[model samples]
Target: MSDLPPSVRRLADGLRRLPGIGARNAQRMAIAVLRAREGWPEELADAIRAARGNVRPCGRCGFFAEGDALCEICRDPKRDGAVLCVVETANDVLPIERAGVFRGRYHCLGGKLSPIHNVGPDDLAIGALLGRVRDEGPAEVVMALGTDVEGETTSLYIAQQLRSLSVRVTRPAMGLPMGGSLDVADALTLGRALQHRQDVGA
Candidate 1:
């Protein structure tokens, strides 16, 4: 790394900072960018900067908000206000949308509970979720969280919190395998899970 020029090395380091990108892959990407047609890498860099600068979290659901208003999902009148689906992260929202099963609003919790990782209920968007539940008056809150232990812990905690409220808290049904990630599951499986969700701690 010390042998490479500062500019090339800097690009590689930046690439390596991205999720799932390793040292070798970053180096290759840097070299490829250097060898690509004129303005190829520059265009990509500009787009990344633009998106980072403009995209913000939705004030309502915590999803991507393009402007000052609520996100598309939150603004949609056709979506069911009686139900709300909660997920661990923004990434999980896309998979559920692709499944095309849910017609309710969504809330991204930002992350799941993991005491070992020092992430607690306070670390997530639980407070905001509770506030939404109170304000929106949803009939049911679907826990579209992951199947991992941490996800389970998070779900249970959320269910307990909402127990006193009038809303019913439930989880996606059996189609999702235990310990599996929601993002990796096929659309069909996810749709089925959403279609037949069961009450949690009922």
Candidate 2:
């Protein structure tokens, strides 16, 4: 805002850069941060700094990890290693985990194929996924990507690549919106979708 001081304006600008945060929300956040209890800002800054400095992608799954270690899901021996759930981003994993239906491990692709956006297979974790499938020989792979055009393209490409393998390929059922992302789906919807997944003919 033109009337706001430079410091507050800068804080609002930074907050506005976050997903789904608009101008009004950014201003409110800036005001809240400025008016918070003593030392709260320092604590928030420290937390952000620590997470940024320490968090890294899992070596196998591309999910969030700490330094060189694997993610919690990848390290869990109780999880089903024979089934891998593939998704567009690390954020997509949380909703499925919250749904509590899939006991399998995950593989984040970082992003889907988007020619307009210049995102291709090489830009994602497809190679690593193929290598894992070849080495580990998973029984199944669930393509839990979005139903958008880019997502469809990526899924088809992956399925084509995996066609030579013996594993079965499937996708979440029709309950999920035709063009929606996994992150926006509610737990109940995600659970139901996973429970009724359909074959991809891979």
Candidate 3:
């Protein structure tokens, strides 16, 4: 590392900040970027800047949207408005969609409650979700979150918050392993879980 040029070192450091990228992997990626065709690095930078500038979270569901527009799912008329699937992050929505079992709308919580990490109800999209439930009058809101401790806590909190509403709060069943997150679940597993969701008492 001491022998590396300052620019290369900086690139490696920046790559290292990505999730699951260790020091060795970041260095390899940085080297690969440097060795690519002459214009690739600039193209990559331009693409990144474009996406960062043009993409934003959907106002209704927290999923990826272009500018102020709704996400594709939110715009689709075929989706069922009677149900809403709630997840932890925008990325988590992909695996569930890939499962092709849920045709309802979605709500991304941004993250779960984690006292150790100083995350609370206010830090998430819980308030928006409650407002949606109240206004939209969905018959069901699936808590399609992880099965970890924080996930359970967040689900319970949301369920309690919606206690006065007529909406039924439920969670996926059977297929997912304990402590598993929605993003890591396979399509088959997610589909089965959604098909067998059980009621959760608030």
Candidate 4:
């Protein structure tokens, strides 16, 4: 490595750990930080530290929350509790929310089922999801996961587990491409897909 200061090297190393950030991008980011105005890096560091310290999983929906209980969306009285949208991660929730088409609550599965990665039902918060469905008594659970094999497996698992429940389970219409992620989908496409969701069988 070049003769960069230890602090700069450490920052680059930390940045490299982030998803999609390679060594070159990490080095660029570290240099950018060094060139920033005074206190910028400190502010960024404080924000990252504070977020890590304060954020915790929502006890009800598995979304990130400031406390040990429900997230802001789950706690909102205006949101419809009768309909629940199931997503793969906390980040997936934002894009769906930004679509402004879904007014129901959400259940974050944390991740999809990937046999290759050894991520099974036990690895996810599936039990919590079933419990939420039982308690909330939602009319429908919308599977808003990607169209990949893992996503399909997860959706099927949820459907099977909830078969005994009175609530119906649905999925988005076949507009989204296979293996596509919701986070990168356009608002219009997501909104339309949500509006035309189809029912799933037990």
Candidate 5:
């Protein structure tokens, strides 16, 4: 790293910060960007900056949006407002949307309830989720989170919290594994999971 120019090394470090990027990959990417023709790197940089500055979380659903407006999904007039799908992070939203099985709005919890990790109801978007339930009055909320221990705990907690509300809580069934993340699941699998959903307590 010391042998490389300071700017190149810095670019590599920046690339490494992205998810799934490792040392070799970041260095390769940095080298490619440095060797690219005029205007390409500047375009990438400008796009990155533009996204960082303009993209904001949707106030109602926690998905990414431009400015203070709701995300495209939440703003869609044809989406099934009566059905809401809840997931752990904004990344999880993309896969479900790709599956194209659900035409409802979404709520991103940001994370799961992990007692060992010191994450609790307050740490997640539970309050916002409850508020959405009350305000939007969705007839059902599908917990599209992972199937791990933390996910289970969060699911049950959410079900309990919404128990008093006149809403049916369910989870994707069949296709997902015991410790699967929705982001990594295939589109067909996710579609099947949504199609064969099961009630939370059942």
Candidate 6:
């Protein structure tokens, strides 16, 4: 049984459920929140609630947005629709955006194909991706997926699907940490990696 107050213990338990947050870190964060001067907890709760309520998947790319329609990036006219970058998740968009090397639009796959977890191509947004590619008629599709087995598998599948299309498919040049999440990579590293992407074969 936890000796902390019910509210504090509840918050700690909830925090612990988050990825990378252990019991000790959760307890520390809970204590820190308890020590805050003003309505920090309220602010945090409001932010969480706002995100949960307002954020929805973008219609074109599967990125998170405040409305039921497309996200800001996908809606922007200045973005290069002729080139699309395929990534694993909505969060993965941040690092690529930060790199500023890609002026193109994005296609979030929701996740990589994981046969072990029973997550197959059907489970991902592959159909939507194919539809978007066919409709948009992009010149190129840049795959910014991780270098893990699942990532490679997903990339190959996407490349295979695009083979009949006129669009060129490519993968980022080596340099990114294998099996690493793009969300955590430095901007410069990612930019360099993007600048040297290699063509994917048919």
**RMSD after CA superposition, every candidate:** 6.6, 6.7, 6.8, 6.8, 6.6, 6.9
Clashes of each: 0, 0, 0, 0, 0, 0
**Residue-level lDDT for 31 in candidate 4:** 99
**Which regions in candidate 3 have their CA more than 4 angstroms from the true location?**
175-202
- Model 3 scores what on Cα lDDT? 0.94
Q: Find the 10 residues in a row with the least total lDDT in model 2.
A: 1-10
Best candidate, TM-score-wise? 5
Please provide, for model 6 over 134-182, each residue's C-alpha lDDT reduced to its tens digit, 9 standing for 90 to 100: 8999999999999889999999999999899878999987668879999
lDDT of 2 at 95: 100
- Residue-level lDDT tens digits of model 1 in 37-58: 7897889989998889888999
lDDT of 4 by residue, 1-202 (tens): 5678999999999999999999999999999999988898899899999999989988888788995767999889999988999999999999998989999999998999998998989989899888888888999999999977889889998999999998899987765566999988888778877877767782
Give the TM-score of each candidate: 0.78, 0.81, 0.79, 0.79, 0.83, 0.81
Question: What TM-score should be assigned to candidate 3?
Answer: 0.79
Q: Give the TM-score of candidate 5.
A: 0.83
In the range 77-126, model 2's lDDT, one tens digit per residue, is: 99998999999999999999999999999999999999898888899999
Tell me the spans in candidate 4 whose CA falls farther than 4 Å from its real position.
176-202
Q: Write the per-residue lDDT of candidate 3 for residues 1-202, one digit (tens) a residue.
A: 2567989999999999999999999999999998997898899899999999999999999999998899999999999999999999999999999998999999999999999999999999999999999899999999999978899899999999999997899987658887999999999779988987777893
| Residue 72 in model 4: lDDT | 95
List the candidates ranked by lDDT, beginning with the highest: 3, 2, 1, 6, 5, 4
Best by lDDT: 3
Candidate 3 colliding pairs, count: 0
Residue 42 lDDT in model 3?
Answer: 93
List model 5 lDDT by residue over 119-157, tens digit each. 989999999999989998999999988877898899999
User: Candidate 6 overall Cα lDDT vs. reference?
Assistant: 0.91
